[model samples]
Target: MSKEVSEEAEHAPPKDYTDPPPAPLLDVGELRLWSFYRALIAEFVATLLFLYVTIATVIGYKVQSQNDPCGGVGYLGIAWSFGGMIFILVYCTAGISGGHINPAVTFGLFLARKVSLLRALTYMVAQCLGAICGVGIVKGIMKHPYNSLGGGVNEVASGYSKGTALGAEIIGTFILVYTVFSATDPKRKARDSHVPVLAPLPIGFAVFMVHLATIPITGTGINPARSLGPAVIYNNRKAWDDQWIFWVGPFLGALAAAAYHQYILRAAAIKALGSFRSNTRN
Candidate 1:
């Protein structure tokens, strides 16, 4: 009987409802290694490239649209530029750094127990620095045009209230961070997670769709670093005035998403299922 029980246990399927091991709040072990540095470098370069391409596209489009609204790529094209760049950059750097080019995404993942505090903080710093450098490069090359076109700084559009603008940013970031959590959930089947083409598309699409919805309201600042880069470089009072919305809205949205996905959607379902199983057994 003992041998039979042992064999049966060995053949049993893995538990269906097990939560992943929670990452420590501060993972000191990760900080002592060269791999950590490599990951940070990847994040820095990816964010830099992302900001450079997107900011230049914004400036270029504005310059081309000079007098005619129909002259340049317009709103839809600008949205695509931001989305497409994120897809490319995420794909390129996902393996090296988890491809968190946005600090909002990092914060969401940190709250969801996907990464440690140290990693989240370091990634945010790298991303912000990268963004600054990226926008600086654009300004350096196209100094006059860049500044003339507002340096691609995000601003609340005319006729919109600050409350409405903040709400737009909050919802936009919620969509983005929610998609990131769903895409990168480790509990996803191995085949799905390992599919080289799967994860980045949804995240990129989220950015694209959110931009389409919120661009006119708050110029679509779902990433605080993206907003800060242009604002810092432009150094305008208007940009500075509404800067808190970009940071506060995205962070709030990210936190809400983490709570919703991790606790309400994931953990609650597991608990309900476990209770159902217990009642059935009883």
Candidate 2:
């Protein structure tokens, strides 16, 4: 009887195998084409919104003096414009593509395994192109000293050194990436945390905080594209020269945040998943 029972168990089909098999791969060329189109449109609209507010703020500040009849918006006002733009964009499109309005955010997501490498590269290219177009539009609209109007064009102010500027960029980017990782962590979701409510708020405030601290130093370009847009049109050599610091600092900070979030904080969860997979295989 024991032998018969064992044979019956071995011969029976697995209970989980009752479901239908997954569909075979199909011709996905059309799907890919449509996806690309949607992504491009989304990027263009988002970038235009961002640059419009940013450049408008800069122009308003530069052209209208403090003593002018209509007082200009000050530096703090400009900072608020940037933060508010980001908050609106994130709330609008975060569901579609995680609202990576900046390339550094895209790179960080790729490092965290939230986005694929190919997607990351594509998103970066899209972001850069959108930024250029956005600034180009601003140039067309503004009649004043176009070079000086767009938030100083990433140039360091009178007293700030290159090292100091770079330090500010690095520190600002580090804080931004750290906040991003914390806000988007899946474990936080598992714990029923209310991240989505203040997701855009925290990110926008992070930008505001960075600018508040670093505007006097390097104009606080935590996003390379933000610097690149105005710099390209303005023919600003200082902005071009210091562009490397913006890219390198933000990327390095993002990498560090991704590593810390994936390996350090989630090591136990990873081990637990490994054990579960091993048991399933057995």
Candidate 3:
């Protein structure tokens, strides 16, 4: 009788039979075909909106200076326009493609294991292309020689050296990326509680702050694409020469922030995984 009861128990279905299989880590079909295309389009459209509004502000300042001669929206205006546009676009597209208008953000997320390398590369290309289109449109409308406009390219002012310029960009981007990580973190206090009303606001303010601090020093290009647009159109040697700093500084800063968030802030999960591994080994 005991042996028969044991055999009956063994033959019974598992108690948690309703539990679903774990989702695939990567959906080859979606990642290769659908996600790639969707992410690219999202990047392109977001970047276009970013550059369009930003460059429009630049053109407005220039045109105003020429027309009004006395009163014009200054650097603050340009900064606000850029920052506001970023916030709006990010909120609009965050669900679609994570709203990474900057390559630095994409690379940072990739490093943090939040995104894949292929997606990052696709996003970067789309951003660059969108930037080119945005600035090209601006040039077409203004009929302004790219050279005279300096293509809205970023550069160190007369008093600043390359090192100083790079430092400014690094610091500026660090602030931007850090704020982005905080705002978008699903586990963050604001996000977890379902109170995300102020999420986009902080990001915009961070951009505004970075710009206010660095515009005078390096034109405040936390996004390389922002600089790329005007620089490519202007075809300025100075812009090209200084371009490396924009890419290097922002990327490093973003990577640092990502590392901090993933390793430091999320260390508990890492430790849990380690413990699980050790238990399995034992």
Best by TM-score: 1
Write candidate 2's Cα lDDT for 149-179 as tens digits.
5544777778878888777787888788777
10-50, model 1: which lDDT tens digit per residue? 56577544467778999999978998999999999998998
In candidate 3, stretches whose alpha carbon ends up further than 4 angstroms from where it belongs are 1-28, 66-70, 145-147, 189-198, 268-282
Q: Report every candidate's CA lDDT.
A: 0.88, 0.73, 0.79
The estimated TM-scores of all candidates read 0.88, 0.80, 0.83
Ordered by TM-score, highest first, the candidates read 1, 3, 2
Q: Distance from true position, residue 177, model 2, in Å?
A: 1.7
On residues 61-169, what C-alpha lDDT tens digit does candidate 3 reach at each position?
A: 8767775766568988888998898889888888888888999888787776676666777789999999989888888877563435556778877899999999888
CA shift of 37, model 3, Å: 1.0
RMSD of 3: 8.5
Per-prediction CA RMSD (Å): 5.6, 8.3, 8.5
Better of 1 and 2 by TM-score: 1
